[model samples]
Target chain A: MITSGDHMNWKDNLIKIAPYVAGEQPDKRDFIKLNANENPYPPAPGVIKAIEDFRGADLKKYPDANARPLMKAIAEDLGVDADNVFVGNGSDDVLALSFRAFFNSDKPIVFPDITYSFYPVWCEMLGIPYRTLPVGEDFNINAGDYNCENGGVVIANPNAPTGIGRDLSFMREILDANPGSVVISDEAYVDFGGVSALPLLREYDNLIVIRTFSKSRSMAGMRIGFAVGGDTLISALRAAKDSYNSYPLDSVAIAAGCASVADRAYFESTLKKVMATRDRLTAELRAMGFEVPDSSTNFLFAHHKSRKAADIYDFLKSRDIYVRHFRKPERISDHLRITIGTDEETDRLTAALHEYLG
Target chain B: MITSGDHMNWKDNLIKIAPYVAGEQPDKRDFIKLNANENPYPPAPGVIKAIEDFRGADLKKYPDANARPLMKAIAEDLGVDADNVFVGNGSDDVLALSFRAFFNSDKPIVFPDITYSFYPVWCEMLGIPYRTLPVGEDFNINAGDYNCENGGVVIANPNAPTGIGRDLSFMREILDANPGSVVISDEAYVDFGGVSALPLLREYDNLIVIRTFSKSRSMAGMRIGFAVGGDTLISALRAAKDSYNSYPLDSVAIAAGCASVADRAYFESTLKKVMATRDRLTAELRAMGFEVPDSSTNFLFAHHKSRKAADIYDFLKSRDIYVRHFRKPERISDHLRITIGTDEETDRLTAALHEYLG
Candidate 1:
């Protein structure tokens, strides 16, 4: 009989998967963390008030399973009805549920070759067959590449590691072509000046637009994300979420998310600051001989003319200035993705780069 | 050729699932809210301080992907190594990931017929085939019934609704029989008085013990749950979680969980109070002609001798008293699962029952 000697065989049933590695969360308190695209500003004042006013005693009960309060807040903020919104722990959770709910066909789903790293990881984890269409030579997604028979299509607007945003016209073209496929517009960084697919939701019933508070609303620690689409599509995602975990959004998150969305003034103010810093840093990197793309999001993707990107990344780390570098697919291996931080952090990073390049 | 007229064809790929319906979360503030089996007492005093002292500014940063601090706290509380712990949004999340990680064989997994309804919902959602065995007439899980060729085994000790707990000797019998499969001992209610399968972890490498903060710890709103097992089993669960959502436990939850686990005195006090209330209520219920089961959990499972449970349920709800009643699996149709609330809430529930039954 099989015992401890063969206990390892029990793992044979679990399919082997290579998990997605998130950007490093460094331990040092003084490091300039410009790796993950988290918002540089603090959350809204209302959010802080909500946390302060929150009663610890009330946590004894289960939170609302539907997350109705947060969903209503998101829907109202987006100028949509409550039925059209679906909320989750984070956008990754939202995207994962969407994949399980919509991409169920035998045909291969399609996305850009250089997109969010987690996209392929989800496909591999869920056993969904996928094909990666290469981005254009200019680091832009060509709408024509997605006009084919497929199970689903996911486009990260202002596509990651490239920071190039697509227009509503480009999104409309893809939605028009894929009449039978569900198209997910992951607008994680859309608030940073990218064109959102939300406007096309009325014209395209197959479109699902996902947004995250981690970037714009400055609540990464609270883990709030929502998806907006037609009611039918939203119901499918809701069903998928309910089936997985009934109460993914805790009470504090619901309250914090509501407070963050209600404070539009603070939100817009932070967005302006992030974009200003991103634009200023773009010019600085260019003057330093780096070929930087025009970024619509909060980060810049670039490679130096004469220096190795990995070497620059290492040098930045040595100076406690961190940035992201992807070494996969070999196409964008030479590029470094730097998240826009506060003005002070940006200045520190600039000084570090000057010292390294000299 | 498919358009809005056939737009729902996209949903065809999605398997039609009957989502699990959690207990009613009534909007009114006055309801007793005993239907969900939540703790009546507030969380540890340290937990409140942790929340009040929390820095809202730090919310812009992502939480630790590994949840190392919370994991270490739980490990110390359980007297296990940190590597043997796996944490998630809740026990439901932990169990869902475990099902995905371990229950992969073609053989149908086994559980009791009158077990947690979410178990079957998970199997249906994941496409994992399962078989249900009937518990004995006394509502006790029969260990010999699980001694069969199966893909996996799941036993909710101090079983839900029935409130019957099996001994560790019984757990050993099942574990010894299933040397080739993973055994998940869901002790969601074990803190009250139930025997734990945690001791058997040293002997059975395939055994996993799942616990929740939603019950005795009084942090249901925080959404924290964990599993303790051999390092190999825990590693597989971690890989599955990292593949799904790298940060399921947000900042507030981690802080609250760590505080709650550290306050051993407060945790034990609440447990004793709940058990005392449960025991007193059991006697009062028996005197009122209800055959109350000997419960090891914080709830009582009882059925009236002459009163129909459905009518009694409605009558009590009309008076703003809440309790759980299962309609399916005819065996438990006549019974009601009443959570042990505070002494005052207990008095109110007993009075309501007396008013109706008499």
Candidate 2:
């Protein structure tokens, strides 16, 4: 008995929900492109070769719904059984599905207040009640804060924007406190520095670790991400994924992901290069009177003592250098998150900053 | 306070829901893949060229979130503005998003009982109530059946497994009767013969027409689908999509989609070839005493008077020829949905059938 007006009013839950705003992807290609934390190096040569060798006749058929080849590759690389893995379009898609499958409870879940912004958006969209636990003044997650009763817990290791990683023992504390609740350790940036909670999966049935190829593997445009956990947890995600979209990864992505995982030497060399650049860039910024954190990831979070964070961001942008600046959660309003790029790109960023400040 | 046992229990709704089962994609490479109704021809040469030309450096960066280039090409091809379009990973993803955005009302939506089996799966996953109206003895959707009060209406043009296309006037009648409901015309198979409801978008604000690159464009492995509608409906779908997953299509998919759409000559020639083969296949089946429907699609839905459908399906499979057979809804249980392959493939299928029945 609904009318036109009723149809126009989308689901009440969806109407008021605020969608997550991803980092801006400026149209101009000539810019330094450091805003979204993308890897400066191209993907491994094997990845490019895979796409080049793909046959047109293969595209005439649907991709394997299970993505068995990619799953097998990931399992072999991670030293886990195929049953322990689950893959999706990207970590965003994987996290969204996990929220639907595991986090729907009457009691609220708990997460760090200043973690990945997408966590709150997922809860809002799914109508799951949640409570945000504030991070310490140093912008580090306090494991004790998650000891209370809750439906589940999510933590992004090497937390974004802040770029600091917690020790594995700290993550174990959170998992031990909530033996029944599912504790998701998002290790998207784990390859850069942080000790992955992957080892904890052997002992904790409730631990689910999520990772992405956007950073270390240098395949962001291909859109591949995955989770590793106990067989039961992985099965629930599979059931949910099947009910939603059967073939989330296309054939091309599957091929590219397999090739990237197989070329271990290429991946190791690129990650080492990024880490070296990050250390050098951090020292240069601190010497320029910026309060740079002890970053464990490929990005540096810092603020100037005299210049406003927004001003520095604008100045950098004007010089064709992009960095992320957040306007809300007032505690971190003065901060700027600059992604670590190649040696040349990092040198250009430092030179630009020195000129602007002088 | 949720405890360990409480965490083990999933959402009440998801536990009882049965996920949709897609057409089988067997692991074997030698079989003639007619089960999923995929286009027999390879995608346009431009699609292959796009993949070949993609740079490894580009794969390191995140793809364009808005997919502007592909959107522009689709808009130009469809004679619509960019604001009127919304794209997704695949047509299945597009349909799932639409159900979440538009069909969460108190009243149950209506769809043909014998159409795409995925419709009910989407409803169950989203917790939306829906009723399936039975098709007529002729396997045609009676437009009058949709005159009742409901939240929405969904029709698959050149309906699956039946391959019957209703005229434009009948669709207009349904749209006229359901002025308050959102009428979704899924034109996944419309490129084969049916008149698209795209033209009606000018007159009806509540109409949404969905199209896919999987069918006529022969890019199923790329996973791209889109919808065209009034700006308001498109905005609602956008909100739902952004809330769920921001970037659904990968960069390679966007590039491949644009190339496929731009090659008009290749698209038309391939579609014409498919239609011609479909006609010949239908006549040959009828001559062999099979009850074949007047197909307006790339697939033929037929059944034999004396031979069992399951038997014929198995016989074909033994010879490496795969066709779809549905066992539910009781009405179409006897039918076999066979995708029209190339001329040589069609000859093989007919020859196989003759041997089995003889």
Candidate 3:
């Protein structure tokens, strides 16, 4: 028989580590959820049709370990060869594998200090040494800062929480300087008007651009994310993934993913709608005395000069409007990262903000 | 510009590792697949209903990262508290997380020499040192052999490729001996007439019994597996999982898993049918001069007295019947591990075997 005392001895690394905390997924669905930067619209009509038409017998057998058909579809959609594509359960899964595949060394990997919170958590969990380079005052990535001695580089394009995107030339500069290390551009929000580093794959073998269906394709519930890179980089990622979990994507995900990739028209129309709503929201937030950054992604990073960000967040919550507000880095404590929702949701959010400010 | 030749360097550990090869999911579905140990019957009717009724709007937002609802359902079904359950994309995912969470130390972890092949692959990928203890001459786990100094222990109940299950008392003996370490009873095949170590969880906080929806519930393609353990162990696994991928189980999987668990009668009926077919197949193979073990899984482990296992495998493949035959572990090189499929699949396999033997 074991006792409570036996629980004290988990691995030393795990014991000292703090896990990543995702944005709140409140139980109540009545809120206008502007948190998590998720797509406000439904997935493509084809995705729904594919799910409805899925065969029950297929669930009796194991899914294709490689998910070749979905990978092929993703590759064609991204204008890459199937060999250059590697998929995972989600972009987080892909990123974790990539970190294992590429970022273990004597030197530390480098990323922006205020980038996606999960990067540092991954580094801590894997025991990979990493140094955080701070983003500029404007919350834009300074590529010059990352061209140093390091194991690798990971930059979220259209950087999360900030919604700022660096130009392709800046990405090229980093790639050229870091010829020996893998530089991953997490393009989770690139579909929302940000320029992708995918074209950089042809120029730099070290460049791996990660994308996801969660944000743009409106399939966050499905968990599909993939990486596009040179064959060698992709091969390494595949090796790491296969070693961990062979069939990461289930049949439903694969079918939904394929349908999502094939329906280019719906993807574009939805993205355009989000971008339009984002512009409108940015204007409204600015009109209300909030300094809204020019967002390339679907979210606006805004700070009210008079009101506390936390107070605004709490006030919005009271009115059932959910937006993200991070506590760390201290500098952005006064900022609220609001995801652009449907026109109605945006209107509701602005009205709530006006009432709170009044 | 990057060239194809730039593919020379990956991490040293990854470069040295060889990925696990899953059973071939042949594109052609005409052949009888008895290779990967998948369930023969379709998923529960409720599972199908869940899939058909999945809303597109739900897919727009991220799934509940912790999968609390499904965990609650699983816990209720398993007669455990929700805190005792830790769910993942599959049992493979659960095993991977458990390995990372518990098995990292100077001392080497241990497992059976001929258990699931992924165990060694995970060790190689994660740099976890593991020593393999050979099973008994009869291909059964000898608990006494495991009562030694080690970092951790992972035993697949009803050990894979050789469908023999160790009794709960024997598991208790191993647990009582290894009080300082976590003993993961991978009960992947335990539902097939094998007694689970779950009842021992009240006495042993160190015992973690893993279960899956793939085989018994006929939801392999949906990829849901979970671990039941003390709160401390479950907390550690959850921490590791959250650190890695916040949302491993997609919405479709959660819904289907809940539906499958709720349909108790369907699960029991399907398992009974497989067990019945397995008994009949074992008798037929024994009549054909094969040594068949008393299988406690949805598969049979048999060896022909005179024929080469590789030759038999090839012969069956030619006849559109697929069965697993591993080349390593020379003691079992002559053995064939065949999954208990539908009655018609069993008949076809026997007919092909008779033709080959005649």
**Clash statistics: count for each candidate:** 0, 0, 0
lDDT of 1: 0.89
TM-score of chain A, cand. 1: 0.97
**True-vs-predicted CA distance for residue A135, candidate 2, Å:** 0.5
Clashing pairs in 2: none
Q: lDDT per residue, candidate 3, B101-206, as tens digits?
A: 8887767889999899889888887788899999888888889888876788998988998999879888988988777788899989998998899999999877
**Comparing 1 and 2 by DockQ, which wins?**
1
**What lDDT is reached at residue A163 by model 1?**
93
Best by lDDT: 1
Per-residue lDDT over A69-135 for candidate 3, one digit per residue giving the tens place of the 0 to 100 score? 8999998987889989998999999999989888867788999988888898889888899999988
- Would you estimate the TM-scores of all the predictions? 0.98, 0.96, 0.96
The DockQ-derived docking category for candidate 2 is medium
Sort by TM-score, top down from the best: 1, 3, 2
Best by DockQ: 1
Ten contiguous residues with the weakest lDDT in model 2 chain B = B9-18
Which residues of candidate 1, in runs, are more than 4 Å off? Answer: A1-8, A19-22, B1-8, B19-22
Native-to-model Cα distance after best TM-score fit, residue A269 in candidate 2, in Å = 1.0
